[model samples]
Target: MDIDVFAATHAQEWKRLDELVRRRRSLAGEEVDELVDLYQRVSTHLSVVRSAGQDPNLVARLSALVARARSAVTGAHSSSWSEVSGFFTRTFPGTLYRLRWWWIGASAGTLLVAFLAGAWVVLDPEVLNAMQTPEAMRQYVEHDFANYYAENPGTSFSAQVWTNNAWVAAQAIVFGVFLALPTIAVLAMNGAGIGSSAGMMIVHGRGEEFFSLILPHGFLELTAVFVAGGVGLKLGWTIIEPGDRPRLRALGEEARAAMAVALGLVVVLFVSGLVEGLVTGNMVRGRIATPVGLGIGFFVEVLFLAYVYTVGKRAYRKGETGDIRNTPEAVPVAG
Candidate 1:
C-alpha cells in the first residue's frame, strides 16, 4: 500500500468527519447517516495507516479523529431498567454488607449512650428534674405520651411519622459530609429522646403502656436510624481517612453509598410508621396487635441483615460498589 497515495485519497473524508463532529447542533437525517458512514471509513483508514507504516503523527491524528467520530455517531448511551434492577439486587445490598462494620460500631455507641441516659434519668431524681418540671413531667408521662399515638387518624399519623423520619435520615446522610459531627449529634439526640421517654413512662408506672406503644414500631424505626447513622459516620470517616486513595476520591465513593442507604431507609421508616399508627393507635386489641407488629419489625430487620451477609457479601466480593453501572468510566473506589 502506497502510504502517501492512500493519505491523499482519504484526507478529504477525514476532513469531512472533523467538520461534521465540530458542528454543535443537531444534524440532519442525511448528515447523521453520513456521520456513521464516515466514522466507519475513518476507522478503517487509521488501521491502514498504522499497518502501512505511515507517518506516526498522521496515524495518531487519524486515530484520535476516528475515536471522536465514532463517539459522535454512536451518541451517549442511556441506562436501562435492568441496571436499576441490578442495583437493588446486587449493588445496594452488597455495599451494605461491606460497610456493615462501620454502622455496627455507630449503633453500639448510640445504644450505649441511650441506655446510660435512660438509667441516669430513672435512678437519679435530679436528672429528671433537670429535663422538666414535676407537673410537666407528670403530664407528659400520664397523658401526652399515650395521647400522641391517637391524636390523629392512623393514616395521617403514619404519613407524618414516615416523612419526619425520612427527613431525619436525609439529614444524617447529608450532614455526614462534614466530618460526621452532625450525624453523631443527631444520633445522640434521637437516642436521648427514646431513653427519656421510656424512663419517664416507667417512673410513672405506665411501663406496660409504653411497651405496647413503642415496641410495635420502635425496633424497626430505631434500626433504620442506626443504619443511616452508621453509613453517614462511614462517609465522614472516609473523608478524614481515605487510606491509600485520595481524600476526595474516597469521599465521593462513600457519599454515593451513604445516599443509597438514605434512600433505602425511606421505605423502612414508612413501614415502621405504619406499624406505629395502626397497632399503637388501635385501642381495641392493641396489646395483642403490638407484639405482633414488633415481631414483624424484628423479622424485617433480621432478613435485611441476613441478605446483606449472604447476597451482599457475594456481590461485594465480585466488585460491586453500589455506585451504579458507571463501568467503562473510571470509577474511584475508596478501598
Candidate 2:
C-alpha cells in the first residue's frame, strides 16, 4: 500500500475515532488515553515521512504506522459498540472473561451453599414445620396477602412498580459490594426456609397440597432468588479475583456489572410477587387455571434465562474490550 494513501485513510479514521471517543461512553478516559498514545506515535511517523521526502523505507514505515493506527481505530470502534450494547442489554458475564472463573465459581458456590443449607432443613422435619406453623400460613394467606396490596394499590401500575423496584434494586445493588458473606447468608436462610417447609409438609402428610400450592409461583420465585444470588456470588469473586488490577479497581468494575444484574432481578421479583399474590391466592388449581398460566410463566422464565445466557456472554466480551464498569440478597433458590 502507498504510504500516503494509507496515512490518508487512517487519518480519516483517527479523526472519526476522536469524535466517537467524545460521544461514546464506553470509550471513556482510559480508551482515549490509548488512542492519544497511538496518535502521538502516528504524528511522529508523519513527521518522519515529511522529512524523508518519499524515501522507500520512510514510505514503508509510514504505511506500517497507518496500518497500526487503522487497526487500533477499528478495534476501538468495535469494542465501544460492544460495551454500549452490553450496557443497554445488561450483559456482564461474557464481557469479563478474565473474571469468568470467578463468576462461574462464585455462582456455583452460592448455589451449592443454598442447596446444602436447604438440605439441612429438609432433613429436619421439625424445623420445617416450625417455620410454616399453621398460624403462620393462615396469616400469610389472609392478612399478609391482603395487607400487602393495601399497602400498595399502585404497584400494578408501571411507574410505581418501577419506583419501588428501584429502591429494592438499590439495596440489592449496594449490598452486593460486600459480596461473599452477605450472599452466602441470604442463600442459606432462604434455602433452609424452603427445605424445612417442604420437609415439614411431607412429614405432616400435606405434601400433595404443598406441591399444588407452591408449584405455580414457587418455580418463578425460587428462580429469581438463585439469579440474584448468582449476581452476589459474581460480586464476591470480584473481591477475590480482581485480576492483575488493584483490588479496588476490580471490585468497582465487577460491582457495576453486579448492580445492573441485581436491579434487573428486583424487577423480576415484583412480577413473581404479583403472581404469588394474585394467582397463588386462588390455590384451587381449577379456579386459577393453573396449567396454562403456570406453563406460560415457566416458559417465559426458561426463555428469559436462555436469552440472558446467550446475549450476556456476547455483550460481556464487548464490555471488557470497551471497558464498562457496571447483586442480590436471596430470600430463596429458584425451584
Candidate 3:
C-alpha cells in the first residue's frame, strides 16, 4: 500500500494515540500504556509502508504524529514521565531482553569455547593432548587463553562481536530463513562441544574434578549457551522458511523473540563466571566433592532449561480458543 494511503486511513488511530500521550493527566496508567502500544503498532506499520517505498504523504503523516508525540512527552504533560517509565518497564525493556538472547548465545558460545580452551591447559592436559596435542595445549595455556582472558575481563564486548559475525554469515546462507539447517547445525555443534568436553572429563580422572571446577559457573553458562543456540536456530529457520509472511518480514518477527532468548543467555554466563571465579575458585577440595558439586549443578541446569525452553506455559491459539496470545502462538509476542 502507498504510504500516504496507509497513513491517511490510520490517521485517526494515530491521533488518538497522540491525544492519550498529550492528555496523560486525564488518563490512567493502564490507559496510557494501551495507547502507547497502539501508537507503536501504528509506527511499525508506517515503517513497513515506508520500507515498501517512500510515500511523501505517508511520511508527512507519520512525521506529524511523531512530532506530536514528542511534543507531548517534552511539553508540560507531566504524565509523560510515567508513560516513559511504563514504556521502559512494559515495552522497551522487553524488546531489549528479547534481543539479548541472540547476544547471550553469541557471547556464551565464545566464552564457552574460551573457557574450554583454558580448561584444556590446567584442568585436563590429557584430554587436550588427546584432542590436539601437548604442544597445542601449551600454546593455548601459555598464550591464547591466558592472554585473551587477561585482556577481556568481562567477556561481554568481545563475545558480542563474534556472535554478530556468526549471525551475519549465517544470515547469508539463510536469507531470513526460519529454523534453517544451518541454525540447527550451530546449535548441535555447541551442544556437542559441551557434551564432549563434559564427557571427556568424566572419562578421565579429571571428570570428577571438572564438575567442581566448572559447576559453579557451568550451571548458568551451559544453560545460557543452549538457550541462545535454540533462539539462533529459531531465527535461522524463520529466515529460511517464513511461512505466510515474506521472508524478511518473518525474520524480523522471529528476531525479536530470538534476541530475547540471547539476552537471558548473557545474564546466565556473566553470573556463572562470577560463581566459578569466586565460589568455586578458592575451594581446592577433593575429586569426589567436585563431581558431586557438578552433578548437582547439572541437575539444576537441566531442570531449569526444561522449564524455560521446553515445557513452559504456552500462548493461546487462533480460532481454537481464547487468549492464544498467552499460548505458544503468542509466545514470541510476549518475548
Candidate 4:
C-alpha cells in the first residue's frame, strides 16, 4: 500500500477513534457503539500498515492510537464495584447453588466418615487405646483440646485460623486439577481428626466441653471446607466428563468458577475465625458465650444459603457460568 494514499484514506477514521478514546467518559450510547466500530476498523488499519508501510512514524502513530482506543473501548464498560457486585450476586453464589449436589455429597460423605470413626472408637476399647495411651488421651481431653483455643491472643488466633483455613481452601481448588485426589484426602483427613477428637473427649466424659468449643466456629468453618472440597472435586470431574464442550475448555471454565469460590471463602472463613478466637476461647460470665457464637455462625450460614437460593437461582436461570467475561480476542472459544 502506498503510505501517503493509505494515511490520507484512513485519517478521518483514526481521528474519530482518537476522539472516542479521549471522550469515552461522556459518550452517548450510539457514540459508544460508533467508538467500538471505529476501534475495530483502526485495529485492522494498523495491521495493514505494519504489514505494508515502511514509514516508521505512521506505524507508530497508528499503533499508539489502537492501543489507547482498545483500552478505552474495553475499560469503559467495567468498574471495580461492578466486578464485586457481579461476583457476590452471580459468580460466587450462582456457582455454589448450581453445584449444590456436589457439596451436599461432600458434606454427607465427610460427616458419615467422621461418625463412623467416632463410633468405632467409642464402641471398641481397643481402637481408642491403640490410638493413644490413656494418660495422653486424658490430657488431651481435659486440657489440651480446650487450651488450644485460648493459648493465643484472640486477635492473633483469629488471624491464624483465617489464614490457615483460607490456605486449605485455596489448596483444595488448585490441587483439584489432579483428579481431585488431594481434595478427597484433605476432606477425609479433617473428618478423621474431628471424629477421633470427639471420640476421645466423649469417652473421657468431656464431650460437652468438646462440642462447646468446636461448634462455635466449626459449623461454618467445616461447611466452607466442604464447599471448597466440593468445588475442587467438581472441577476434577470435568476431566472425566467434558460434556458437549472440549476437555480443556471445560476444565478452564470450572477452574475459573472454582476460583470465585476460593475468593469468596476468604470472607466466610474470616467470620469463622472471629468466632473461634473471640467466643470459643473467651467466655462471658454466664457461660453462654460459646453458644452465642455458634448462633452467630449459624445465622451467617443461613443468610448465605438464603442469598444463594434466591440470587443464585436467578443467575443460574439466566445462564451465568461464573467465569470472568472473556477478552475481545477470546469470543470465538466455544465455552
Top of the candidates by TM-score: 4
Q: lDDT of each prediction vs. the true structure?
A: 0.77, 0.53, 0.49, 0.81
- Deviation (Å) of 8 in candidate 3: 13
Q: Taking the tens digit of each residue's C-alpha lDDT, what string does model 3 give over 1-335?
A: 44457666777788788778777668887886776677566656655653543443454455556555545544643377886454323333343343345545555655566456545544665655677565764454344532332243334533543454345434422332544556555554654565555554544445555445555556665545544554565567665666876555465556544444344344445555544443443334232355555665576566554444332222111121110011111111210
Poorest lDDT segment (10 consecutive residues) of candidate 4: 326-335
TM-score of 1: 0.74
Give model 2's TM-score versus the native structure.
0.54
For candidate 3, the 10 contiguous residues with the lowest summed lDDT are 316-325
Comparing candidate 2 with candidate 4, which one achieves the higher lDDT? Answer: 4
Best by lDDT: 4
- Identify the runs in model 3 with alpha carbons over 4 angstroms from their true place: 2-130, 134-182, 284-335
Candidate 2 local lDDT, 205-227, one digit each (tens): 56665565666556656665555
C-alpha TM-score for every candidate: 0.74, 0.54, 0.47, 0.77
Location of the lowest summed lDDT over 10 successive residues in candidate 1: 326-335
Which should have the higher TM-score, number 2 or number 4?
Answer: 4
> Model 4: per-residue lDDT, tens digit, 47-90?
66545525545655776787778778878445689979888888
Name the regions of candidate 4 deviating beyond 4 angstroms: 1-71, 284-290, 326-335
3 versus 4: better lDDT goes to: 4
Better of 1 and 4 by TM-score: 4
